[model samples]
Structures are given as C-alpha cells and as structure tokens.
Target: MTSEPITVVLGSASPARLRVLRDAGLDPLVLVSDVDEEAIVDRLADAAPEHVVTALAQAKADAVVETIRGGDDPLFDAARTDGVVLTCDSMLLLDGRLSGKPHSPEVAIEQWHRMRGSTGHLITGHCVTRLHRGEADAATGHQSTSVRFSDVSDTLIERYVATGEPLKVAGAFTLDGLGGWLLDGIDGDPSSVIGISLPLTRRLLTDLDVDIADLWRA
Candidate 1:
C-alpha cells in the first residue's frame, strides 16, 4: 500500500518564492498571509534587521496556521493528515538601513541610485511549521547574502525602473530576473537573494523532524 503525501502550505504572496519551491520539486498550496507588514515593522522598529525579518516571517506563518485550523475550507485541509507550512520574509540591509519592496518608481529609482556601486546584505527569514495529528509546532531561521551591484550609468537605472520590475521586489533588484544584469556578483546563497534559502529551509524542516524529501510531490 502507498502512503499519502504530506501537504505543503506556502504563506506568502511572492511569486519568486513560489517559483523557487515549485522549481525545486515541492508543490505547495499558496495561502498568502494577510498580516499587516507595516504594523509588524512598526512594532519591531527598534529590532535588528535579522530580528525584524524573523518576526515578520513568523507572523506570516502564524497567520496562515490560524486560517488553516480555524475553519472548514476544503483547500486548507488538503491532506487531512500531517503537513507543513512555510513562510519567508526578505529585506535588504544597506548602509545601515533595511528596506523591503520600494513599491514606487521614484523610490525604486532612488534605491537603485544608492545601490549602484555598493554592496548590501540580502537577509531572508524563514519559518517552517509542522502540523501533525492536530498539533502544530514551528522552527525558524535566516540567511544573508552579500550582493554587489555594478556601477551602471543613471540611464540604465532609469530604464530598469521603467520596466516596473524593481518596484515590486525587495532591495529593488532580482538575482534571477530582469535585474540580474545590474549586479556585479553575490557572496552567498543565490536562492536567498531570490527570496528563500533552500539550505536554511531544509535545516528548519529537519528541526521540526520533517524530512524535505518526504514532502516532495511524487
């Protein structure tokens, strides 16, 4: 007899994150968290960048956990058995300041202008929640990657911003997308720069006694 596959719930709306997991072989049911990010940041305004991202990722995971256990949404109870929830939050720490999605052309343009010829650490916080037999537990961690940007001309930055890609991602750049050409190089996990660190996620899952391989789609 064959055993049932474990359900994997993703608690963020980031397409990049989703793509990362899917491309890695785990099929997850996306359950975007509705948590107020600004509120979370405001509450942890004095915290360090790592602490901020960790708290944000945990908050998002907790919110999704509530949604899954609070009701009878058929989709939420995908497996009706053991499962796991994954959540992540990313930010760019540059020149002693941390920033998430610029969200505006002007802001993105400004971010790129400052980022050109500079290096920043991309910190991605991760949380993995295990749900087994009506009980839930979580483990969390983070990864940081040093990203160096090319000293491109103003015209290039302006043109990139016009594409509107940078406005929707953290650090105003992507390692695997249109912004790839703007970078000189990186000194850490490339996946973390994209959004989630596979190595870190594996460790977090192991901490929860969940084997990543067991969660992979057949």
Candidate 2:
C-alpha cells in the first residue's frame, strides 16, 4: 500500500524536539505557541507535576488548533489535508516541587546547587491533535524519568552555566549536553528530558490511526 502524507505541526520552538522528529524521519513544521507558561503552571498549583505538564501541553495544542481554524495560516491548510499537531511541555520535580527553565544565570546556578547530590524526576507531557473532517481529536499524556545527579562542584556548575545551555532547559540542565556529566544514571526514557517522549508520542499517534512509519516515509 502507498503511504499517506501526514504533515506534522510541532507546537514548540525547542531544537531538541525538532531534532527528535527529524531523526525519526518526520518533517515537522514548528509553531511556537504564545501561551503564558508561568500562568498555566501557577493555575495548577494543586496538581501533580505530571498533571501540570500534561495540562500545559494540551493547552498549547488547543491554542494552536484555535489559531489554525480562525486564521489563514498555511498550517491550517496542512491540517485540512490530514495533518497532525503535536505539543509538549517538560519539567523537573525535586521533592515534589516543579523546576522549569531558569530565568537567569543566577537561577540556573542556584538550581544546579539544589539538584546536586539529589535524585529527581523529569516529566514531559505531550498532546497530539489530529484534524479530520473539520474537527480535531486530541490526546494528552506524560512520560517521566528518574535522574540521579552526583555531587556537583561549584566550579563545574559555573562553567556549565557559562555555556548558556542550562538557562533554557528544564531542571537547569540538558542530559544530552554537558549536563550529562552531572548525571550518575537515569531510570527511564532519556528522550523525555529533551522535551518529547518518542514511545509516548508513538502510542498516541497510533491511537489516532496515524502510523508513525508513514510520516517517516513522507
């Protein structure tokens, strides 16, 4: 059978997520949502970290879907042609407190200091919206991984912060970057830390009747 062309709309500006899609052989169109992340997290003050991430991911996907339906953007046309929209949010939880991207170098340094000699969980949530017959079907889910960090020295944290990678990453570190040096081990999917969990995403797409391999062929 011939493969169907499935256009993918990525509701994030993260390079790591884009790389994941590309490495999986899917060409995803990037759409950075303008939703206020802090407000969303604040509103979910009573929820678990996994729930909060899932909610934020769904919110971002819904915002993008609304924009596509209400505007003349080309992505809307893509959606009309059996495209899929994907959104994701990630956070680090240490002792039940959520840790998102650090706002400044000092914040990154402080977070690293707190994370030192501690084992934490990284949770990433994904939302998928499949547009069909002018309607959208959406699913939301989360993936978590346990990360253990060795005792990090002040000099090392300072040097890593100077690289500027920690500022934009959850937990103030990127497992694929110099931050890997700090990790003693991980207990789940590492890709979840990068923002998108491949296994979780694959299952969601399967439920929508979209074969990920078909997208790779496209």
Cα RMSD, each candidate: 1.5, 1.4
Candidate 2, residue 14: how far the Cα is off, in Å: 0.2
Q: Predicted candidate 2: what Cα RMSD to the true structure? A: 1.4
Best by lDDT: 1
- Tens digit of per-residue lDDT, candidate 1, span 117-153: 9999999999999988889999999999999999999
Ten residues in sequence with the least summed lDDT for candidate 2: 1-10
Model 2 TM-score (2 dp): 0.95
Query: What's model 2's lDDT at 199?
Result: 93
Where's the lowest-lDDT run of ten residues in candidate 1? 73-82
Estimate the TM-score for candidate 1.
0.97
lDDT score, residue 22, model 2?
Answer: 85
